[model samples]
Target chain A: MPILQFVERDGILDLGWGHPRPGLLPVRQWQDATRAALDAYDWQALTYGHSAGPQPLVDWLAEHLGTVDALTASPGEFFVTAGASHALTLCATVLAAPGDVALVDVPTYHFALRILRDRGLRLVPVPRDDAGIDVEALGALVDRLRGDGQRIGLLYLVATFGNPTGLSVGEPRRTELVRFARAAGVTIVEDDTYRELGYEGAPPASLWSVDPGGPVVRAGSFSKTVAPGLRLGFVQAGPDVLDRLAGIGYVDSGGGLNHSVALAMATFARSGAYAEHVARVRAAYRSQRDALVDGLRAGVPGLDVPRPAGGWFLWLRLPEGMTAESLMVVAERNGVSFAGGAQFHTDPARGHDHIRLSFSLLSPAGLTDAADRLAAAIRSVAG
Target chain B: MPILQFVERDGILDLGWGHPRPGLLPVRQWQDATRAALDAYDWQALTYGHSAGPQPLVDWLAEHLGTVDALTASPGEFFVTAGASHALTLCATVLAAPGDVALVDVPTYHFALRILRDRGLRLVPVPRDDAGIDVEALGALVDRLRGDGQRIGLLYLVATFGNPTGLSVGEPRRTELVRFARAAGVTIVEDDTYRELGYEGAPPASLWSVDPGGPVVRAGSFSKTVAPGLRLGFVQAGPDVLDRLAGIGYVDSGGGLNHSVALAMATFARSGAYAEHVARVRAAYRSQRDALVDGLRAGVPGLDVPRPAGGWFLWLRLPEGMTAESLMVVAERNGVSFAGGAQFHTDPARGHDHIRLSFSLLSPAGLTDAADRLAAAIRSVAG
Candidate 1:
């Protein structure tokens, strides 16, 4: 379908949208932040701004990242984007040419794959295990592609709290991956959108933080932590990389992404409201994740569901002989819905027996009811 | 110079930023409108939205276009964009593949040309006259390109109150251009960014309005009329064209451009605040344009300064023996700045004796002073 059908149909418990639930959105906080921004900045808030974004926001973001991620970055190293998806699009344009090859995790964020492919970059799938992308396998694939006379442009990974899979690469593995990429002369684009949404404990050090000053471009978004409709995110890279990105005609011509909104977010960030909101949402999602995991385990026998420490999803391995597509049919019949894992895979056959359920978009009660419906559907499908 | 330097320096009168003057921006109105929107829509304003945009904003834009442009279009005919530049980028991607030919007006909006070229489209400059893009020249260029076994993918023009020229294509010419494009199997992308900012009377019928179902795609921006930082704009096209654009991975994956901002704009539009703001900005720019034209004519004898009835710029043909480059050096020495007309031209040599003066970013007194400085610079350069 040309348009992704994401409308919540009546009576269907949908777990497909990988976004925060409506109740978790910080509406009042944002309104106040915007008002404060407009009042303080006046028309400057509404003017066409620098392509890197407003200086205050850029400065604040740099410091904020240092405080939270233990990563020190110069102001020139940051560029605000419309969102992480937009950041990925910009990276695809600046980092690689149309015919270049990008190495991506097999069960990657589907839309990230779409964004890269749309830029005409060929994607080579690198298989992943529970520890995240298999670094040795990726290294071998890079060498193989090089042997075939192919130029490997970029290595894309959801290095922290990955989408759909919810696996984070360990710090040592991240270091190894970065070393391999630098050795192979491939740029690494770390999708860090979910890094700050840790439910149980802190996620591992980001690939960018682990190998600062290396060829790592990290993309982070406010969608998971703040609000998606704001369409605000940031890309952090070395000065050289950022300069190249800032030179893209889209940014150069338009003078930055989401300027007024970015200014409002800066106000929120400075006022300590953003952190508070993120904490509240993180707590809510943590409860939602617990409810979904506990309820699904109790309801469905022999279903291997992994508990994600951060991010939105819980990856469920279907019982042997029960395919995700078959379960989806029964789930839909029972008025429950989820993203079939096949959608996340470059090769659909590899993920047929898995499904990705999001705990971020439903209430705790709604999640429990969804689990019950899903269990009932599974029993019917097995029969 | 990969990043455009638009920073306003001390003690310099800059006419380089073709944006509304600070005092003219409707700060209070926007603050109120945003507050109202947040109160009314709450979390819906902050959630991930549809790829085409929020339905209310889309519907309002369709109706607004119908009322203002005398065009009839269904909601599906409009797609929200970050702004006109982003819209142009999206159109470049959807309408033509890389390495295809795009016939653009010679002195077109420079950023439009940049957007197309950045997408790897080969830009073929078609000469334009006072009336607008020279239809005969464009036709010949298309035919010549086709004769060379190349595809003429699209014809790009700033049909209404064109940037750097302020020439609107008459209705008859618009019809002719659309017919020619349709006959030649080439799409027409009319940048109507400044259409609504007409200072004298309403601008001519948009190319899309003139031929609603033809291969005409009209791009309009609230950036000029409302606020640039909102980053809101829309592309009006036949349902087929819009569907194709909406199907682009950029839109399908990101869910839409600037959703919360669009919703807030819709509220402002529905409340009639947007129209009032446009009228206010138009009046201010009109006076500024008039002051510039009068001041320059009186100061620099025999200079041909065309008074723009609408939009932001005044195109001036320098007196013989005075190149825009020489004038710019003298003007900069006198603490005044303006865009050398060559910057807008695909072939720089064609516009060396011309300069573009933007009255959009300065007060009447500031513009008058700038005109005096420019005239002094011209005289110095002539000597």
Candidate 2:
């Protein structure tokens, strides 16, 4: 058994991790894809590849985004990365210098915030409502930072099926965000890692699609849709941005981030196995989401559980006066665990009353059971 | 055919790239390894893995380094990276902030220079003789920089079979360099990527191994020994350094740089296939190196070609009045290509009389033909 399996075997009913459940991973398809990739390519498959990645993969991605996601990006705009985090790191490297300020959603993807901060960008969290990042608030923040002589270099947003919050910015808000970024002269980085894994219908039009050739940079990943193990993702930006990213010393020296694996994923994409796997995963996640929501509503009283249009999470605002910290203690005692909302907050105190539950890694039945346990925990905490 | 095969199919004899020859790549073995990795491991293989990379791979690497490379390092000292360049980048990110000084060899690996410079480090080139980087010069340079109030953050060296120059530091120099780093309070980053590729025998002791627990960071890669496309490498540093690297938000958020690939490589290592493959490659490289060296000696009179103890390169100093640039023009016209020594120089003008030839990617016959063509081009340029 792998170490993770051994560690996770204690049956804690984990709802904190957002990894796709095991049943959703298409192991057999990947086996075929790996075999086919090896058989199809020569030693070039194992040699230093193009810094932008395999051309076939790049071309396939362009077509897939255009036809499937309705995001029309040319091959020149795309550069393969190790994953979404890697792509974000590349963006941070190019768009912002150390000490520059990046405006992010208040309760953003925790890791996304970490990635940006790690690159030495000062993250200024902009508040968000049910619709997503409040565009007006972002504009005000950008103006305030600029007035203070702070260089607002980047605007990072998980615009579609956002992590932790499960919020998708409406199409109009995406356009507004892009407009605000353009006016502020800041590059808008849209992390669309969960875009393809929407449990409902497709998420809103990507910020890149809404404002093509604008300052919007879209980062897409196969991690959520296909398999995280592949560590394959791509960034779509304007020609100038693409050139800048491609010229980074890391890519220049190492060639593309991940070569053979990218080709294998390309094989998977070209063979249409990728789309098939995504569809299966989407259906599984949709059911898992429904089960969790239904169980939560049925078991918990006076809980505010917003129905996520799409994405992996169900954001729960606990009953008034009940802190997530206090409830989490009760929940753990009752054999359930979840990501504390405080972990996602830029200001930890702001998220004390909420919790983020990820249904992606649990079965429908598992999620239902988790919901019951969490409800009991909440009641115990409230009492 | 993959794009690389098409690009390389042209009749130009490329003596510049240092990739393993196609025949030397263990394609069948990797296929088996991939299958075995997936079969032996559970769903954890496809999930976000431990931030420090799979523990098994880390343990295996520790054992391999101790037994095979004669370098003793605990697992805590190792942090897996995407590749040697990635390892170097991480070292740059942590050891030196931007504007810090990194002392490097004058005519070093061009890409190494680029990776450091890309991280915004001020690279100070210290002179090097045939025995690799001059320890005395490095110490003097450090003293000067410190006196100037400039922080000397890192001393980067490819100690074993140095790239482009193919010069390995003697054991005594390794100790001297480590001691100097300790005295100067500067971190010594010993890039030992080519250590295992020694044709005749094992290379000199790694700087880290020479002075364990000293201020030495050793970077190793399977790129040369196994395959570059795998994008796998490791840095063996003190526990503190490893912890800092592992704590980098990029690694933490991404759950390790490349998990599945690392696991796959671990499977390859544990299976004994890696040892067999390395031995086979070493023998092939030895023959190719001899062929290139013999052909060059026989074809070109008064040429200064140092027989490398191991590694991929044959560094050549042309006869008087023959610049590498002028020879390269004639060589390309005659269907041969080499890395002009100027490309490796900190100041391009200094390497006008030098050139680097790599035999790792060519068959013995190919190397012989390339050498003959190169000789003809040299004669043409000399005239």
**Clash list (residue pairs), candidate 2:** none
Regions of model 2 farther than 4 Å from truth: A5-11, B5-9
Docking class of 2: medium
Error of 1 at A210 (Å): 1.5
Q: Each candidate's TM vs. the true structure?
A: 0.97, 0.96
Model 2 C-alpha lDDT per residue in residues B1-383, reported as the tens digit of each score: 13442256377999988778987877878888887888876566777777777888988988888865656667777788999999999988888988999888767788888888888889888866766667787777777888899987788888888888788887677777778778878888988898888877667777888777679888888888988888999888887787788778767776767877888899999999998988888889999999999999888877777789888998898989888888878898899998888878777568888889999998999999999999889878878
The residue-level lDDT of candidate 2 at B7 comes to: 51
Candidate models: Cα lDDT each: 0.83, 0.83
TM of chain B, each: 0.95, 0.96
Q: After superposition on all CA atoms, what RMSD does each candidate show versus the true structure? A: 2.1, 2.0
lDDT of 1 by residue, B14-118 (tens): 887787788988888888888888898898888776787788788888777766676756787788899999898888888888899988876878888788888
DockQ of predicted candidate 1 = 0.52
lDDT of 2: 0.83
Model 2, span A50-140: residue lDDT tens: 8888888998888888765766667787889999988999999989999998888867788888888888888888877777778887778
